[model samples]
Target: MEDLNEVYLSPLPDSPYVKPFRFNYTQNGKKKTWDLLEIHDSVAIIVFNITRRVMIFVKQFRPAVYYNCISRQDRESNNIDTKKYPASLGVSLEVCAGIIDKNMPVEQIAKEEVLEECGYDVKVTDLQKVLAYRSGVGVEGAVQYMFYCEVTDDMKTEQGGGVDDEIIEVVEKTIPEIEEMLQSQSILPSPPSMVYALMWFIHHKADKFRKTFERTCVECKVK
Candidate 1:
């Protein structure tokens, strides 16, 4: 994944995910114009593995994120110096998520993502709706629905690395580890929805998991 070579940039072609357009509007008798990108809505999940006292996440390389961090000259040159900025810089640790391309319920989509990206077969009813909000308001203002679900070891159906061309890595982080990342001063290469979901878990579910962990430790000591 670290190897990046012979990279080139081209005009945005026909794509299923995004389309660019210019919008002209009149407000208070004043003409206004804005550049916009129409994008698909998406679903994200905050997955907790109660059996392991850890949170499930996914790590994958994003081309947009990678492009933004590299030098403009390198970008325009159609070549990047991997020695200067490695491709690992573009890999992000994020929650299991997917675009809402299907006509099914959003909850179902979230459930499928859990299985497809994280290998957990969670029921649709188990997907508790956390909230929904607009993402990328400056460009493509698409709605993103967030959900939370808990999984046990028994729920694991496969070693999910995503389907088709997706090269996702399933990551498990303990509460303390995630807390450290949340408190770190350095920027984490993750999306806003992922940060918000982790904060939500720390506020809502961390204590419960800690209590269970403590109890299990005590039981082990007594034995």
Candidate 2:
């Protein structure tokens, strides 16, 4: 999936998802203008799979991540060499997430994202509210609603790899493996929301899940 080539830069075109604007204001008798992007609020879900005893994440290529990593000279030249940089640098491991484009509740959007991105059919009530925070504070400053959900093998309706032209891979990591990543100095490229959600899970839900898993294993062994 990391076979990326023929990368180039282009000017920002008109889009419904993003709108750039300049705001002028007077502060202490000085007039100043700041540029910002008007973007839709988003929802992120931290999915824990009880059947597999792992956390579910979605891995996908992010254009902005790729654009920032390549050499400026290569970017300006409109051609990027796959040998030096490699496309893996552009891929990121992120929680199940989506933009709030429809008028439905954020919980419903989060539910759909889990099913579409991770192949988990969970109910809206299955999603527990985590916290809401502002993302892209400088440029966009859009509110991102966060949620947590647990799923089992029964919820797997299909191989959720995203819809339309999106190419996403579902990744699963055990708790110990994730903890090892947390201790590593050079972790993989991931978003702040994913890290925060993992930390929240460790602090709030990890122990309970671990105990339940251990008890279930012992019960099965005894049986």
Candidate 3:
């Protein structure tokens, strides 16, 4: 096991949205220095509409991924995997997520993200902490909090009020469809943390999730 001799080097820039901290560390006898960018706490919601047997996901273009591929191909042409071409870098389908604003609560962020990303007005309940992960390890230290949210099928009947600058598209898929995508590796563009969290929910909470869907349908008369 490699022991880390961690020490705070200096504080970097501080902003309303993020605070950057510089640190020095020794890992495996090698000295290293890096900056950790801490953003306001955030929440991600996996909204499952049981009646439709579907989970809600959002699509957006990511510039980081777009440039990553070009850089990789240029640097390692011979080592590049041709099988992984036509990569869906920009088109990432992920669970609803957003940063918690300064004064807003975590649950509020979760609800807001669900509505913004999927056009769903869902009561964010049964908030299970899925995982905390560093979104961009190499460049940024954006820690993301993920959760599972139960939503009604009619949540998307009206126009979704997403952020003004965000070009988001809502996608709903069945469990079997998600399984097929996983098998086909078509979900490569999604964040691995979210995929793993969804897998955990499927493994641990599938039965209860199904029951919730049935109850929601019964109450809404969406038969």
Candidate 4:
């Protein structure tokens, strides 16, 4: 955490999310210039339901992803309107996440994100940080902090669909199904946070989760 002081004055035309700017400085004696997209730093949370032995996810449609996946011809084609198909083509299964738009600490933001996007009551300390990263280095550099948390049945405080003006579908998947999804990248396009979170769990907590799942299965079998 460094000093928090920056004022963004420039923005891309007709787009609220991205701010385009130019960076000019001397690089090894010669002056260098770079055009960049100023994006906000954010937090991502991988919510695991230890009680039910399932990983919580969210399904949402992203316009940028839809636009990127569409070809030039498709964008121009009149036979099938690209605008009509964005809903189906843009939906992605992803971990609960939100941008750091407030003055609160990153952990607090993560906690709010978990509650708003995943329907879980969680403490800031219960949230474990997975990694911090630069989201898009090619065009711009936006810090992304990833966290992981586990919730129980008692934590079901609300049905999450984000705060306001957001339509997020809460989804839960078993470890096996998640494993299958990890391999199927095309059918269900996943973000880096989602994939890396699963990978981190596998590398660090898979054994414990496996036992938990086995115990849960036994309990289900007994009933």
Cα lDDT tens digits for candidate 2, 94-134: 98999999999999989999999999999999999999999
Candidate 1 regions with alpha-carbon error over 4 angstroms: 211-223
> For each candidate, how many residue pairs have backbone atoms clashing (under 3 Å)?
0, 0, 0, 0
Superposed by TM-score, candidate 3 places the C-alpha of residue 206 at a distance from the truth, in angstroms, of 3.1
lDDT of 3 by residue, 1-223 (tens): 0111221123445567556678899999999998776666667787788676688787776544543655544434444332353335446777788877758667767777777777777665645667777776675766788888767766665566367777767788777666666666646667776677678767866656453444456666773
Question: What are the runs in model 3 whose C-alpha is more than 4 Å off?
Answer: 1-22, 25-32, 72-89, 126-128, 133-139, 184-186, 207-223
Each model's RMSD to truth, in Å? 3.2, 3.7, 10.9, 8.1
The order of the candidates by lDDT, greatest first, is 1, 2, 4, 3
Best by lDDT: 1
Off by over 4 Å in 2: 211-223
Candidate 4 residues lying further than 4 Å off, grouped into runs, are 1-16, 76-86, 185-188, 211-223
Give the better candidate number (1 or 2) by lDDT: 1
Q: Model-by-model lDDT, in order?
A: 0.88, 0.87, 0.66, 0.79
Task: Quote the positional error of residue 28 for candidate 1 in Å.
Answer: 1.2
Could you give candidate 1's per-residue lDDT for residues 151-177 as a string of tens digits? 999999988889998899999999988
Candidate 2 TM-score versus the reference: 0.91
TM-score of 1: 0.92
